[model samples]
Target: MNISAIDLTIFVFYCLLIMFVGLFVSRTKKGTEKDSKDYFLAGRGLAWWAIGASIIASNISAEQFVGMSGSGYAIGLAMATYEWIAALGLIIVAKFFIPIFLEKKIFTMPQFLEERFDKRVKTVMAIFWLAVFIFINLTSILYLGALTIEKIMGFPMIFGIIGLAIFAGIYSIYGGLKAVALTDVIQVIFLVGGGLITTYIALNLLGEGDGAIQGFSNLYTKTQDKFHLILDKSHPGYKDLPGISVIIGGLWVANLYYWGCNQYIIQRALAAKSVEEAQKGMIFAGFIKLFIPLLVVIPGIAAFALEAPLSKSDEAYPWLLSNLLPVGVKGVAFAALTAAIVSSLASMMNSISTIFTLDIYKPYLRKKANETELVRTGRWASFVSLIIAIAIAPLLSGLDQAFQYIQEFTGFISPGALSIFLAGFFYKRATANGALLAAIGSFVFSGLLKYIQPELPWMDRMGIVFIFCCLTIVISALIEKKGVSEKSINITFDLFKTTKSFNIAACIIIIILAAFYTIWW
Candidate 1:
């Protein structure tokens, strides 16, 4: 794990470049300052490419590089269902979700709740999101990112955690989403390039230097059990994936919630210059997602094939980097890992500030806060949130599979949140009271199910909870004798339409995914 001088140089240069880009984009002309729109939504100016790159950049992090790789090591390619299914999820979000969001002109997810339901629901969900973002999302990212740094550089975990927090906060806290999104374009380049290099090297080593293709062939031949797309009951990892549930059941709830309803993720699409731009960006992300397993999962399977010595499954990616990469290439791969970590941290921080300032502070604490004051408050919010996450991040050090831990805990909120949103979008009779019940019941139902039926697969439990929440909304509305709330969104077919190119790209993605599952099934 000893770092060579050349690798250290490349990593340093990459950090400086990212910081410079972030700061440059954040710069404002004299007498002109960033308003809430500029700071929170990137001034609603992001083009399709930036939106696409930023979405994936913010999405893939140490969770995938470290945690998901760990899952790959333990469960094999079955771990890829999260990424592959997410491709279809992005398309669904693009077609069904983004249009409503853009049409409503909402800044944060909480604002959408307020417009569709009531302030009570908005406030409750906003607080819930804040807690989850800081405690679960940000903390996990920092912990896993630091874990990678510790494995690759042989540094103490605390040093890696603090260093990552500082690097992310330096530009992101000051610049906001504009800086984060713009700089993410470069981050995506490094992330993809470096990740691919690591995969290529690992595969080459597995193939005994025959090349990546032979490496992949050798990997598949030797590790055939790892290639299954669906895991049955007898498989040790079936509980984690739960065979058919991944395709037809609770995974849909997870994907839709994470991609469509999550503030940090949908914020990129919200910032797009147009709805068309947003949809196109989603389409682009879908294509990129199809290849993510190659970068993240294949390396872990390659590690299994090569017999990487590791204390835990999460060490797979780091083991590859430490053992296989040449000096110059190692620097690039490290930069890639750092890029994934910091970009996601920056995105999460920006979203945290956006939700707190716009949804909480402006509405309640400072009813008449102006643009300058709100922007300043957002910056402060970002700083505080990062500090909190950095402090608690070390607690996650004991997790065996951080990815599954994230999914299980986050599921507590996702079922409720997704139920509320889906009801609000399509069910005219959905009342604020009903939405509120679903919001609260989501956590209660999930917890009860987990406690009472500990053997139930987590995905199946989520599906059951989602159904109960949906029913709660329905029964509450029935009891209230409401037909259609005044706040119900007027649906129009035109809002879901996409460009020819977007449609074609989406079709290509679907075809490719179908071929993959067919071959692997």
Candidate 2:
């Protein structure tokens, strides 16, 4: 784990460069009032490239670098279903979800809900999202990031956690979404390039200096049994991925909720210059997602082929970096890991601030708050959420499988919330009462099933929960005598002229995804 002078210098420069870029972008607009739109949504001026880069940077964190690699070490290629399936999810979101959101001019996901339903629905969902961002998303990122830093750089866990918080907050707290998105352009480059380097070196080692091809062949030959795209009950990891359910079952529930409905992921698209720009950005993100498995998952398979002597699967990533990567390259890899960690932290912090300030604070606490007051409140919210997350992050150390831990726990609300959004989008008779009932009922039902039917696969449980939520909403609507005459947001399916570029890119992504599944199936 010893870092050479060159590597340490490179890492320091990377950190300094990121901070400089973020700060520079924050100060770019001189005459503008740091209003709610500018601070929360980047003044709604982000281009397609910025939106696309930010989405990938924010999405890839310790969860993918540390957690998914850990899962790859344990469960093999089956762990990558999350990434591969997400490409398709992005396509769906770009086509169906983003257009609606952009048309409504909503800042937060809860705002969209409120527009379609009522203020009560918005408040309830905002509170739920705020809690998830702080507790589940932020805590997991910090915990796993710290775990990686502790193993590779030899820092104590607490220092690593606090260090990451400060590093991300320095640029994000003041600049808000604009700074986060701008800086993400730099982060995505470091993260992906560094991740690719780590994968290449690890594979090269496995190939005995025969190159990536030989390494990949060696990897497949050694761990052929572990490369299944789908898992049956006979496989030990079946409970985690399950069989065809990964494709047509609960995986869709998770993917749609995440790529389509999650505030942080969708926030970028919402901020795009136009609906067309947003769609293009999402399609661009879908393409980036196609290569994520190579950068994040393959190294774990290489580690397994090498039979790394680690007590925990999460340790596989750090073990590889600590042992295999050379001096200067090691620093770059470390920086990439740090970039992945910090970018997500920044994104989540911005999202937490956005939801709380716009959705909760401005609406209920300060009904007549001005632009300056709202921006001030948002900055405060970001700091407060960071403090809470820092306090709770260390507690997640008890969880062994951090990747699956995140997926399973978040499943509690995803299906229910997704049901509400879907019903609101497609059904005019979907009453506020029905949406609320579905949200609350599915949450409670998901929890009860977790306790009583823990034997069921979590993904399958999600599929069941989504259907139940939909049914509940439909029945509630019928009982309340809410007819199709109730006018919801007017969704013009004919508004967008689907661009040929988007169509071609989407086809390429689908073909690549299909090829992977077909080869591995």
Candidate 3:
């Protein structure tokens, strides 16, 4: 992992560029008192391109680069269903989910729940989101990022985690969503560009100087057995992904929860100038997502072909970069990895701050807080959240299959949350009581199933729990005498109108998805 002078120079320049973009975005045109919108939602001024790039950059992090690549090493191309399915999920969110969220002009997902259901529902959801973001999402990203840095640069795990926290919090705490979104554009450039370069180099090496095309051919020739997109139940990795269910069942639950319900990811779209801009931006993100597997997963497959001696699958990507990438390129690849980790860290920190200040602190602690005070609270919240994440990150050491760890643990809540949101959006009869029951009941049931049905795949378990949640809510709503009222009507079907551009882009994405599934099936 010895970087040459050229490699170190490239890495330093990338760091400086990120710092410059983040700082520049944070500075206001004049010394004016910042409002909540300016700090939390980017003043609702983000355009389609900025929204698109920020969505992808915020979504792509050490999870995709480190955890996903590790899964690719173990499970091969089958692991790519997460990325490909997510592309479809983004399109679905744009067409069906974003319209209502934007029309409501809400800052957090829990806020929408409160409007649609009750204060109880909003408080329950907001608390749940805050805990998961702090304990799970933030902690996981920092751990994976630290793990990657430790492997690549030989930095100690604690130092790596703290350094990433400081780097991310520096700009994000001051600038908030605007800074995060604008700087994310540059982060995406470094991440995607550097990722592509690493994949190209790895493929070129695999091809023995023939070129990337030949290298790809060599990759398939060497590891054709690893190319299955669907796995049978007998396959060792089938329980993790579970074959056609990926297309028709629980994977959709996972994707919808992530793309549609997740606050940090959807916050970018919510900040768009218009619903049309938001839809188009999400579609753009979908298109970008289609290529993520190529950038992150392909390198792992190449690593397998090169037969690098790694102790674990998660080490595959770092091993490939350290062993195969030339001196100058290694620095670029390292920058790309750092870019992915730090940008995601920044995004999550901002989201945690947004949720705490708006959903929890404003409503509970200081109901009459002014705009300036709200912004200040958000900054403090971001800093405090980062400190907690940095403290917990190192405890994730020695966790095997870190990607699966995240997905499985998150499932406990995703099934219930997804059920409540879908029912609230589509079913007028879905009552507050029912929504609360769905949230609490489904989480408890999902957790119980982990022990009761230990043999079932997590995807299958999620699907089953979701069905129960929907049933519980529907039954409870039927039993209750209260009818749907105007007070709870924040969403309208009329808001789901689409542009010609959206339709055309969606059709193209569906066609591509169908072609991939068909070819691989």
Q: In TM-score terms, which candidate is top?
A: 1
Query: Candidate 3: where is the Cα deviation over 4 Å?
Result: 488-493
Give TM per candidate: 0.99, 0.98, 0.98
lDDT of 1: 0.94
What C-alpha lDDT values do all the predictions have?
Answer: 0.94, 0.91, 0.89
Please list the residue runs of candidate 1 whose C-alpha ends up more than 4 Å from where it truly belongs after superposition.
none
State residue 329's C-alpha deviation in candidate 1, in Å: 0.5
Ranking by lDDT: 1, 2, 3
Tell how far residue 520 is off in model 3, in angstroms: 1.7
For 71-98, candidate 3 gives per-residue lDDT tens digits of 8888888888999999899988999999
Model 1: number of backbone collisions: 0
For model 2, the superposed segments whose C-alpha errors exceed 4 Å read: 28-32, 485-487
Tens digits of per-residue lDDT for model 1, 1-521: 57899999999999999999999999999989999999999899999999999999999999999988999999999888899999999999999999999999899999999999999999999999999999999999999999989988999999999999999999999999999999999999999999999998888887786887998999999999999989999999998999999999999999999999999999999999989999999989998999999988888888888898888999999888898899899999999999999999999999999999999999999999999999999999999998899899999888889999999999999999999999989999999999999999999999999999999999999999999999999999999997989999898888778888888888898899899889987
Report the Cα lDDT for residue 394, model 2. Answer: 94
lDDT of 1 at 290: 96
